[model samples]
Target: MAVNLAHFALNADDIPTSRAFYEKVFGWSFVPWGPPGFYHIRTGAEDAPVQGALQQRRELIAGRRTIAPECTFTVEDVEATARAVVAAGGRILMDRFTISGVGHLIFFEDPAGNAIGAMQSDADAE
Candidate 1:
């Protein structure tokens, strides 16, 4: 199966500042969701709008932090994809985990050291 960019999340130190900037500059809308400091971003695109979120910044893995937007790829099976990632010289940073209403997810770093996520959709993941 071909994996696709399913979502992207922006990590911010200051939610209000980042949210306001996106709202004013990009005309994006934010809806509070999930945890206290997390929000769903609406980009107002006419076509198939890509899923996006803004959340508080934290370590991507242990003491290492990610400064760029975290991108998530949708796949049929996260475990299989994770195996392929490792086979292709990538390193798994996190094991598989459920995201309640979202799906099964795994975090990994590419050979180039870019941290990303792979998700397998399942509304009943909770």
Candidate 2:
């Protein structure tokens, strides 16, 4: 049996800001896909569940919007990943948090100022 990660999403406070950030930093391109909160961004064919949209958030985002927006990435170690993020000049929003007892996670911003996250299962050791 084959299993894989596919078709995931990330929320953007403002399409324009997120779009430009991704383009400049990650070289990802965005194209209109569905409705107002929909976009198709160019991404790698790796395990990344793909960014379907950077839609406008209705929650507080970087003092911009007010949407509980988040982007999830498969990581080996949440703490190590977070540490690497800080070493690379990325700011960690929260130290480490839990969600529904599923796993541990942390949020951070990209070089272009786009917020993203890294997550690891609860079974993962520190």
Maximum-lDDT candidate: 1
What are the per-residue Cα lDDT tens digits for candidate 2 across 42-105? Answer: 7876684364557766432356553444566767678888888889988887677875545776
**lDDT (10s digit) by residue, model 1, range 58-77:** 88766777789999999999
TM-scores, all candidates, are 0.93, 0.49
Best candidate, TM-score-wise?
A: 1
Model 2 earns a TM-score of 0.49
Residue 50 local lDDT, model 2: 66
In Å, residue 24's CA in model 1 sits off its true spot by 0.6
lDDT values for all models: 0.92, 0.67
Task: Tell me the deviation in Å of residue 12 in model 1.
Answer: 0.8
**What is the number of backbone collisions in each predicted candidate, taken in the order shown?**
0, 8
